[model samples]
Target: MRGLSRGPPAARPPRPPGRNGPAYTPQRMADVSAPEPPKPPPTLPDAEIAALREAGRAWEKAPGRSSAGPEVAPGLDVAETRGRPGEHYVRIVRSQTQGFEPVAPGWLEATPRAIAPDTDFGRIRRRLRTALLGSPLSIHRVLHERLDKVRALPVLSSDALSSVAYATEQIVLILAVAGTAAISADLLPIMGVIALLIIIVCLSYRQTIKAYPQGGGSYIVAKDNLGPVAGLIAGSALMTDYILTVAVSVASGYDQIQSVFPAAVHYRVAACITVVVLIAVANLRGLRQAGNIFAAPTYLFIGAIILTVTVNLFRLITGSIHPTGTSIHIPMTESFTDLGGMVLVLLFLKAFSSGCSALTGIEAISDGILAFKVPEWRNARTTLTIMGTLCVVMFCGITIGTEVL
Candidate 1:
C-alpha cells in the first residue's frame, strides 16, 4: 500500500467502442463546430440605387434580347472600392416584408451574361439529363417535325388502342359469371352497342380537338362553356380516371403474364414499378424522343391487331369459321326488388357502362395537342380523327375476334 501511494495512478486503458465511446477524427471535430452566419453588408448610396433602378428599367424597356441577354446601357454605377465585387454575405428571410438586402453594388453596370452550358452545376445537370434521356431539343425544335398520318395514329392512339388486348376479356369475365346460361350469346349485341359508343365518344372528341386546337379535353370544354368550378370538377375526374386506368392496366397486364409464368407473380410490384419509371424517364426526355420510343411498340400492337382482325374477318366472310357468338345463354336476375323491369334496364345499363370503360384513356391525345408540329391545330385535328377511327375499328375488331377465336 505504501509503494502504490508513491506514484500517480496509472492511466486507465482506452475505452472500447460502446455506449461510452466512439471513433473520432479531425474532420468530425471540424464538422461539430458550427460556423457563424455571415453578416449583411452596408446599404448602398441613393445615387447608386437610383442608377441600378434606371438600369433595370432600361433592360425591361429594351426592344429585343441581345446575344448576351438584356443590354442595360443607361449609365454605369460606381461599385464599392474596398473588397472584390459580390463577395459579401446576406440572409434571405422568407417574410415578404423583409427581403434580403443587396450584397453587391453596381450589378447593372454590365450586360447580363448568358449561362455557359458547361459552367459550374449546369454541366453536372446536363450530363445527368443526357445520360437519362438524349440530347436536349431546342424550344423551336420541340415538335419541330410533324408526324405523318401513319406515325400520329399510333402516337396518339396507343392508350385507347391498347385497350383491345383486355377490354374484351373484361367484358367476357363479367358476362360469363352468370354461368351455364349461354352468356356468350349476349356478347355480340352488347359488344356491337359498345363499339357504337366508342365511335360516338371518338366523334365527340374529334369535334372538340378541332374547335379547341390548343387542347385540354373535357376540362377545356367545361372551362369554355361552363365555369371554372365545372372545369375543376372535370379535371379532377379526368385525373381520377387516369390513375385508375394505369392501376387497372398494370394489374391486368401483370396477371396476364403471371398466368403464363407463375414466377413473375412474385415480382409483380417490381415489374409494374419498372414500367412506370421507364415511361416517366422516356417522356421527360422531350416529346420527339418519347414519340420515337413509343411509336414502334404502339404501331406494332396496331399491326398485330390488324393482322388478327384481318385473318378472322377473312375466315368469317369466307365461311371457313363457325360463329359461336349466337349460342351463349342469357340470365334473368333481380336485386331485392325481385328483378323488376326497371332493375333489368339498370342492369343492361350497368353492363354497357362497365364495357364502355375501354374508352377511358382516349383523353390523353387532347392533352398533348401542342406536341403536333406546324399548323398545330390542323395536324392535331387530323391525328385526333385518325385516332378515333382506329379506336372504333380496334374495339369492334377485338369484340368480334372474341367470337371468331
Candidate 2:
C-alpha cells in the first residue's frame, strides 16, 4: 500500500502595497456611488403639510385624551402619526377609517352641542304625590294610628296659645310706659278685633291646608294659583314668620318660665333658639313623633287655663273675686286721656294688630298636611277643626279673664 503525502499548499506571493495595506490594483472600476445624504425625510408634500397644520389646530381645540396615541379631533376626524423611532416620519391614516373624511380649507368653526332636556319632573312628582296622598287608609284609621303622636301637635299649636301670655305681658309693659291711666276702655274693642283676626287667619289657613297638602304651605298655594314671584314673596314671608314664631314663642315661653325661675331670664333669646332647634329635630324624626311629644303639654296647658278661667269666672259671677296685686294701686301717668281722637283709634288698632300675633302658627297645619297618614286632606281638616275649637276657647277665656281679673 502506498502512503500518500500530507503537506501544506504553497502560499501566493505578496503584491505591491498601497499607503496602509497590501492590495492589488485591478482594472479601475467604474465610479458607482451616488452623491447626497438620504434626502431630508421626503419633505411632507404641500397638501400634506397644510393638512398637518390644520390637524394641529384641530387637536388644540378638540377633546383630549391622557396618553400618546392617534385621536380624533373636532374638525379632523382622522389622525396621522408624525414619526417613527429615531427617525422622523409622517404617519397618516389610510383612506378606509370609518367616518374619516377630508375637510375643505377654512371649514374649522365648531358648532356647540345641543343641551339635553331635564327629566326630573316625573321623579319629583312621584315622590311628592306619594308623600301627600298615596296611602290607602281612611282618615279615622290614620288618626287612630297616629293618636299616640298627637302630643307634639302642641309645639305647633301652642304658638298661638302662648301669645295670650305675650299679649298680657306686652299690654302690661305698654301700660307701664304710657301709664295705667292711659290704658283706655278702647282696649275691649281692640281685643275683640284681635280675636276676629285670629279666627280669620286660622280659617284661611285651613283652606290652604285642604288645597295644597304638599309641604310648601303659603309658597305652594301662591305658586300654584298665582306665579313664581308671588310664590317667592309667600316663601319669604313664611320663612320670616317661622323665624318670628320661634323668637316670639320662645321669648314668651322664656318669660313665663323665667317668672318662676329668674335665673333663666337673661338667656331668653338663646333659650328660645334652642327650643326651636329641638323642635326642628323632633319634627325631622317624623311628624307623628313630634305630635306625640307636643300633644300632652298642649292639652295640659289648655286644661289648666280652662280650669283657671272657670274658677275665676265663677268667683266673678258670685261677686267674690278681686284682681291679683290690685292693692298695689299703679299710679296713672299724665299721658292718660279719654278723648276719642284719631291718635287713640290708631293706638287701639296697633295694639289689636300686635295682639293678633296669635294667628301666626295657623299656617303650620297647611304646611304639614302631607304629614297626615291617609285621607290626608280630611285628617288635616279635622286637625284644623280641633285646633280652631281649642283656639277659640283659649282666646275667649284669656281675654275674658284678663278683663275681669
Candidate 3:
C-alpha cells in the first residue's frame, strides 16, 4: 500500500533579541540580573601595615605579656613547695616570665634539640638515604669544592672517553658488512675524518667556553643568539642524547662483563639495572665524592689502552708479532662489486657517521665550565684539549691495531 505524501515541516519563528544580545530564558534572565561575584579584598596600605607591625612589637615587649602570670622582678628566691603528703622540696626561682625570657645566673640552661620528622618511616628513609648517599652538603661546602683539571678530566670527559671503547667497533662492523676490501679501503679514511671533526669541535667548544663561562651549554647559547624555540629543541636533544648515552655506556660495559664472565650474559636486564642504580647512588653522594669514585677507573682505562697500544706497536716494529690483515676476497652474502659505486659511497658515509659517536660528550667541558677551579674557562679548555688528544690517539691506535692485528 502507498503511504500518503507529507509536506516539509514548518520552521518556528525566531525569539526576540534580549538586552544581553540573545534570547533570554528564565535561567538566562536570572543570570543576567544576578549580582556580580564578590570583589577581592583590598590590600592594606603600607602605613597601616607598618602601624600594625609596631603595635605587635609593642605587645610582644610588654612587661605583663606572659600568659602564665604577671611578670615579677629578677631575683633569687628559695620557695618550699609541697611534693607529697608530709614531704617538701625547695625550688629555686629567678625570672617569673616565660617564653623567650632570659634566665638568671646559675640557672641550668635548656638543651637545644632538633625537631625531626614524627613518623618512623620518615626517619628510616632519611637514615637509609644518608647511609647510601652519605651526608648532604651545605651550599657553602659544595661551592668551596671545585674540581681541578686532573679530577675534572675524568668527571666531565668520561662519557666522551668511554665512547672510544666502542666507536671504532661500530665503524668496522658497518664497513665489514660490505666485505674486507671495504674495511681496508674505508676504515682509515673514516677514522681520519672523525679525528678532524673532533679537533674542530674541540676548538669550537673552547671558544664557546670562553664566551659563555656561566655555562648553560647549547640551551643558553641558542636561546640568547637564536630564539627560545631553537633553545628548546637543543635542550630536548641534549636530554635524549644523555639518555641514549647512559644506555649505550651501560650496554657496552655489560658486553665486557659478559666477555669476562660468560654466565653474566644471562642476567643482562638485572645487571643493567643494578649498574644504573649504583651509578645514580654514586652521583647522589655529591659531585666531589662522585669524581673521586670515578677518577680511578678513568685513569686506569687510559693507562691500559696506552700500554696495550704501545706494546702492540713495539712488537709490530720488531717483527715479533705477525699482523692479521683482512681478506681481499668478496663474501657471498654481500660484496662491494654487487653494491655498485653509489651504494658503496653511501656505505662508507654511513660508517663515518656511525664513528662520530665518539664526539657525543665533547660539549661537556663547555657545559660544565663552572665545575672547574679558579680560571674555570682556562682549566676547562685545557681539560677539553687533553680529552680530545686522548680520544684521537686511542681511537686511531685501536683502528690501526684492529686493521693490522
The top-ranked prediction according to lDDT is 3
lDDT against the true structure, per candidate, is 0.71, 0.65, 0.83
Best by TM-score: 3
Clash count for candidate 1 is 6
lDDT of 1 by residue, 247-287 (tens): 77777778978999998878999999898788789778766
Model 3 lDDT per residue over 1-405, tens place: 268677798899888887887788988779879688999875999899899999999998999657686565334453657588777675655334221223565443332112234699978887897899886565567886689988898889999999998999999888877877788888988989999999998888888888988885888889999999999999999888888999999999999989999998889999898998998998788778878989999999999999988988998899897755644565625455776788888988999988999988888888988889889888998999999999998988888887777
**Candidate 1 TM-score versus the reference:** 0.65
TM match of model 3 to true structure:
0.71
Ranking by TM-score: 3, 1, 2
Predictions: Cα RMSD each: 25.0, 23.7, 22.9
Model 3 residue runs over 4 Å out of place are 1-115, 325-336
Tell me how far the alpha carbon of residue 213 in candidate 2 is from the true structure, in angstroms, after superposition.
4.5
